[model samples]
Target: MTHDLLRLATAGSVDDGKSTLVGRLLYDTKSVLADQLDAVERVSRERGLDGADLALLTDGLRAEREQGITIDVAYRYFSTATRSYVLADTPGHVQYTRNMVTGASTAELALILVDARHGVVEQTRRHLAVTGLLGVRHVAVAVNKMDLVDWDRSRYDDIVADARALAARFDIEDVVAVPLSALLGDNVVERSAHTPWYDGPTLLEHLEAVPVGTDPATQPFRFPVQVVVRPQAGEYRDYRGYAGRITAGVVRVGDEVAVLPGGRTTRVVGIDLGRGDGTVTELSEAFAPQSVTLRLADDIDISRGDLLADPGRPGHVTRSVGGTVCVLSERPVRPRDRVLLRAGTRTVRAMVEEIIDQLDIDTVDYRRAPQELRLNDIGRVRVRLADDLPIDDYHELRRSGAFLLIDDADGATLAAGMADAPDRYAGADI
Candidate 1:
C-alpha cells in the first residue's frame, strides 16, 4: 500500500524545548542515522552531559549550535509503516517570527510547544495567531517539561485551556493537547508511566492518525497556464496545447472552461499526460494536482499567467483587494509603496493604498491604522492591482488565495498576503 504524506511545522517561545521535542520524536521513531547519532553522543560528552543532547540533532548551523537556539527553518523527513512525514522546525524567538510564517504557510498541522511553567507566553500566542491565519486545520499543543512540574495535571490543564481559547478566536476547529517531557522522552513516541490519568494518544500517534487533504473531485477546477506547448517538427506540427498542473477539482473532455484575465470561453477537446519518459498518456478526465496538457476547441490568445477554470466557479476578477499580510523583509511597507504581487502563475504591479491595522502580539488584538509594517509584523492592507486577477479567498482555495509582495527593484519577497472573500471587499476605496 502507498503511504500518505503529512506536512507539519513546529513553533514555540524561547526555552520552550521545541527543538528538543522534534529531536525526541525523530530519535524515538528511529529516524536518526547511526553516524548522526554518534556525532550527537560525542558532542554531548564534550558538554559533560550524561546522555545525547537531542536538541543537537536539529540545531545544525554552527551559529545555532554555539548559541543554543534555532535561528532559521530546519526541515526533517521521516516515514513510518503507514505514513510519511515532512517536518519544518522553525525558530522560536520573537525576532524570527517571519521564519515561523514561512514554515507554517504550507503546513497542514502545527505542533506548538509551551513551557509547562510559563503556560502561554506572548510568543506562544503569536505562533498560534500565525497558525490560524495560515489556515492550518489541525493543531497539536505539547506542554513540554512535564518532568519539571513533577507530572502535575493541573499545570497541563491550564495551558491547554489557554491554547484552546486563543485558537477559538482564530476559528481553528481541531485541537489536541499532550503533556510530554522532551528531555526524557515521555509521551512523544511511547507512552510514559508518569501520567496514568492521561489516556490520550502519544504525539506521534496523533500525527499519524490526523486527516489530511480533501477530495479533489468535490472542489472547483482551477488551472493556471504555465507554458504553451507546440512542437515545430512533430508529425502533428500544427497542434497547440496549454500545459499546467490542476490546482483544484477535476476536468474532462467537453467541459467548458473560462480563460481568465481575458474572459474567453473554450471547451476542453483533449487532455494529455506526460509520463516523463518521452511518452504521453491521453485521458478523458484528470483531477488536481496532476500536471497535464490541454487542447482547446478554438485558437484563442492564451499564454502564461492565464487561468483555465470551471466557468460556473471561476474566481473573482478584481482590481482592489483587501486581506491580511505578514511582513517578512527588513524594509517596512507603507502607503504608496509599489511592489510586485505574485499570485500563482501571474505577477502584477500593486500599490499599497492603506495600512488597516497591525496585530499586537502581546495583547492579541489589533492596533488600528499603524504607520508601517516592519519585519515579523502581521497587519491588514489594501492593494490596487494593475490588472484584473481571478482570485479566491484563502479559505476557498489555498493555492489561489495566497500571494506574495516582492521588491520591484530586486525581487526580494517583502510579505505574504492572504485574500479575503469578494464580499468582504465591497465598498472598498482603493
Candidate 2:
C-alpha cells in the first residue's frame, strides 16, 4: 500500500515544548539534515545548554530565538517507514491566536502539548477550543514536562480527564491522551522506560497509525472557482475554464454541475489535472484531489469566486449565517456592524444583524444577549450574506463550512467563524 501523507498541527502553551516535540519527531524519523543539527547544536552551546536545543529547529526568526518564543507557524516535514507527515508547529503565546488559526486551517489532526505540572491552564483550553472550532477530528494530547512532575500517573490521569471534559463540550470525539517530556524525549519518539505506569503509545507511534484523508469518493462534489482560465494571447483564446482545487467528492467528463449563486447548471465536458493528457471522462468515476481546469458543456457566465457543485447534492446552505465570533483585533465588534461574509469561494457583503450571545469558554456557558464583542471574546453574531453562498454547515465540510471576514477599507483579515446554519445557533447562549 502507498504510504499517505498526514498533515497535523502542534499546539499548546509556552514552555509546553511544542517546538521540541516537533523537532524530536523530525529527528527520530531521520529527517533532520547534518547541517541543521549542527546549527541547533551550535546555538545550544552558545546558550550554555548541555545538549542541542531541538526547539531551535523551529523558532526560525531572530526575535523568536532571542525571546525563546514562537511568533509564527513553522512548517516542518518528515516521514517514517509507515507514513509521511507535514507538521504545522503553531504558536503557543496567548496573543498569537491568529497564527494558530492559520496553522490549523488545513490540519487533519492536532497534537496538543501541555505541561504535566501545570495540568489544564487557560491557554490549553483556548487551543483546544480553537482546534474544535476548526473541525479537527483527531487530537493527540501530549502532556509534556512530565519529568518535572516526577512522571506521576495520577497527574497524567487528571490532565487527561480535564482535557477529555473540554473536548466533550466542542464535539471532538477521537481524542488520544499520551504522556511525554519533549525536553527529555520521553514517549515522543522512543517509548520511555522511565514512565513504567504509562501504557499508551508514543506520540510518534499514534501519529503513524491514526488515519487521515478518507477517500473523497463518497463525498458530494464541490469545486471552488479560484481563477478563471482564459489565455487570451494564444490559441486558447476561446477556451474558458474554471480553475480550483476540488474540495470534496468527484467530477468527471459529461457530469452535470451547477454554478452556485447564479444557479445555472452545466455539464463537465473536460477535466484536466495540469499534467499528461489530463482529461478524464467517465461521469461514474471518482476524481481525486488535484488542481484541474473544468470545461463545462455550456458557457453560461461562470467566473472566479463562483461555486461549481454536483447538482445531485448541492451544498444545503442557509441564506443567513449565524456563528460564534472572536474579535481578534482590539476594536470591538458591535451589533449591526457590516463586514464581508466569505463562505467557501464566494465572498458577500454582510451585516452584523444581531449579537445573539457570548461564550465564556472557562464556564462552558453562553452569556445571552451580549451587546458587543471585545477582543478575544467569543460571541454569537448573525450576518446576512449579501448573496446566498453555496456552503454546508461547519459540521459538514470543514473546508467549505467557515470563512474569514475582510475589512472593507484597509483589507484587514478579521475574525474567523464557523458558519452555523441560518438562525440555527440563536440559542447558542454560550
Candidate 3:
C-alpha cells in the first residue's frame, strides 16, 4: 500500500534558517540528485563559503539568491519510507505575510522555525496567529541553529516554553518543540550526540509518526461543479455528467443530494472515473479531493458554479456574509468598493458593506471600525454579494468556506478570505 501524504508549510523570520532547514531535510533524506548538489556546491565555493550552501537548494529564484532571502513560496516534494511529504517553503519577511497565508491555506501541519539565539519574535507570533486562523491543527516548533547557542538545554527549554504559551493562546493544542541545527544536520533526519540531553524524537521521526487526523471520507459531502460534460460526438452521446473534484466527504451512487442556490433535490444515478483517452469506468463511491464526473437520475438544471451537497446538512445560501480578510494588494479595501468574490469555481460581483475592524497582531485585539484595510492588514469585513451563494463556515469546511477577492477591473487578486472566526478568536478577549 502507498503511504499517506502529509502537507506542511515552513514559516519563520528572515535569517531564521528556513531555507537551510528545508535543504537539510532534502539533502539528508537523499532526495536531492547529484547534479543539483553539485550546482549548490559550485555556488557555495564561488561565494567563498566553507560548506555547500544548502539554502541554494530551495532559494531557486535569481532575485531570492541575490538578496540572500526567500521572496516567494517555494514548493518541494519528497518522501520517506513510511510517509510522503509536500513541503511549502514560505517566505519569512514580514511583508510576505500574504504569501505565508497562501501557503498555509491548505496545509495540515505548520513547521515554525525560531532562531535559538533570538527566541520568539513578533513575526513568530504573527505567523502562529495566522496558522491558527487557517485551521492548521498541528504545529512543530523547530528551534534551529542550536549549534550557534552551544546546544544548551536551558536555552532550548526556555524557547520551547515560550512557543507553547503562544500556541496555547491561539488554541493550538498539538505543538511539539525540537532543538536542531539545520546547517549541521543535527536532529533533523537523524539524532546527533551533540544533544545527548534531548530525549524526544528527531524532526523526521516526528513528521513520520504524527497522526493526520480522521479520513476526509467521514465528513459531509461537498462537490462544487466545475463543468458540465456533454460531448455530442462520442459513443456515449446521451451522457450528461457534472465534472468536478469532491472538496469534502464521500459521494456515492444512489445518494440523495441537493444543488445549492437553486435548492433542487436529485439522486446520483452513476459516477464516472473519466480517463483522458475517451474511456471511463463506473465507480461506486468517491471521496474528498478526487476528480470525477457525477450523473444524476433527473435532468435537473445544474451547471458550473453550482454546489452539490448532502440534503440533510446543506450549506448556507445568502447574499450577505461576514468574515475576515487578509488584504494582498497595494490598494486599500474600503466600504462601497466593488470587487469580484471567487469561491470554488464561482465568481460574482460583491460590495463591501462595512469594515468592522482591523486585527492588532500584537494584542490580538480588534481596532474598531477601521475606515479601510491596507496591504497585509487582516480585518473583519461584511460583504453583500450580487447573488446568493452556498457558502459554509471556514472552521467546519475549509475548502467550501474560503474565498478570494479579485479586482473586477484588472483581474488582480486582492485578498484571501475566510468565512468565520474559530471559537478561540470569537471571544471578547481575543
Candidate 4:
C-alpha cells in the first residue's frame, strides 16, 4: 500500500542552512544511493573537509556548489514508513525571491529555517508574509545551528518566540518550532541527546504526521475544462465530454453543475477515465485532483477556458480582479501594462489597471501606490480583463484563485498573483 504524500517547500535567508537541512533530511532518510554518497564524499575531500558535506547533496548546480549557496529550486523525493514527501528546496537569496515563490506555490506546508543567532530577520518575515499570502496553512520553523549557539535553551526560546510572533502577523496559526543543527544531524531525523530540553517531535516526525490535503466533501466542486473531447470516428463517436482535472470538491452522476462564464446548468450524466490504451473506465463519482472526462446532460458550448463548477457555489464572473502580485520577471509591471492572465487552463488578455501598493517585507507593511513592481517585489494590483473570467478569492480555493501574469509581447511570465479583495492586505492584518 502507498502512503499519503506531503508536498512541502523550504525558505530562508542566504546561508541559513536551508540546503544543509534538506540534504540532512534526505541523507538521514536513507534516500541517497551509495554512488551519490560517494560523489558527495569525493567532493567534500576535494574541499579539504573531514567528512561528506551534506549540503553538497542538494546544491546540485556547479555555480551553487562553488558559491556555497542555493541558486535554484531543487526538488527531492523520499518516503518514510508513514508517508511520502516532495521537498522543494528553494533559493534564499533576495534576488531569487521569485524562485522561492515558484517553489512554495503548491506547497501544502512550509518549512522555514532561521539561524538561531539572528532570530527573526527581514527575509524570515518576507517568507512568512509570502506563506500567508499564498495561503499555506501549516508551518514548521527550524531554528538551525543550535550547536553553534552551544545548545543554549534561552537563545533557542528567544528565536522561537520571535519567529512565532512573526508568523502570527502573517496569520499562520499552525506553527511548530524545532531547534536543531542540520550540519551535525541533531534533532532532524533523530532525537539528539545534545538537546534534552526540547520535547517536541523532530522535524521529520512533524512532517510525516502533519494533516495534509483538504476534504472533498467540505470544498465546493470546481472543474476547469481543459479540452473538449470529440472523436470524429471511433467507438465513442457520438460522445461529447469535457476533459480536465477536478480542481476542488466532488462530482457524481446526477449531480447538478453549472458551467461558468455562461451559467448553463446541467447534470453530470457520466464520468469517464481514460486508460492509456484507448480504453476508458467510467466512474460513478470523482473528486478534486482526479483527471476525468465528464459528460453533461445538455451539450453546452463549453471550451478549454470555461469552468464547470457547483452552481450553488459558482465563483465570480467579472472583467476586473484585484489582488497581490509577486513580480517574477526582470521587466517591471506598471499601470496600463498589457499582460496575459492565466488561471488554471484558462488564459485571458488583461491590463494592469493600477498598482495599489508595494509590501515592505522588512516591516510587513504596505507602501501605498508604488509606481512599478520590479523583479522580486511583492505588491497589490488591480487587473482589468478583456473578457469576463470566473475568478475566486485565493482564500476560497487556492487552485482556482491563483493566476499568472505574462508579458503580452514577449510571452514571458511577469508575476504570480493571488485573487482577493483590495482591502484584504490594506492593513497590518495582512
List the global CA lDDT of all models.
0.92, 0.81, 0.91, 0.91
lDDT of 4 at 148: 90
Query: Candidate 4: misplaced stretches above 4 Å?
Result: 421-430
Instruction: Summarize candidate 1's per-residue lDDT along 234-311 as a digit string, tens digits.
Output: 676888999999999999999999999788899999999999798999999999889999999999999899999889
lDDT of 3 by residue, 39-77 (tens): 999999999999999999999999999999999998899
Q: What tens digits encode model 2's per-residue C-alpha lDDT throughout 1-430? A: 6789999998889988888888887777889999999999999998899998888888889999999899888889899887888889989988887778888888999989888888889888888888888889899999899889888988999999999999989899999998888888889889999888888899888998898895787888888999888758677788777888888888878789988877788888877666567644323343546667788888678777888888878876556877766677666777777788777678888888888888776786677887787766677777777777777777777777777766766767668787776546446433
Candidate 2 global TM-score: 0.93
lDDT tens readout by residue for model 4, 256-352:
9998888889999999999989899999999999999999999768899999999998988888889989999999999999999999888999999
Error of 3 at 312 (Å): 0.9
Q: What is the lDDT of candidate 3?
A: 0.91
Q: Which ten residues in a row have the lowest lDDT in candidate 2?
A: 279-288
- Provide the TM-score for each candidate, comma-separated: 0.97, 0.93, 0.96, 0.97
Of the two candidates 1 and 4, the one with more favorable lDDT, higher being better, is 1
Q: What is candidate 2's CA lDDT for residue 218?
A: 80
C-alpha RMSD for every candidate: 1.7, 2.5, 2.0, 1.8
Q: How many clashes in each candidate?
A: 0, 3, 0, 0
Prediction 3 TM-score vs. true = 0.96
How many pairs in model 1 have backbone atoms within 3 A of each other, for residues 3 or more apart or on separate chains, i.e. clashes? 0
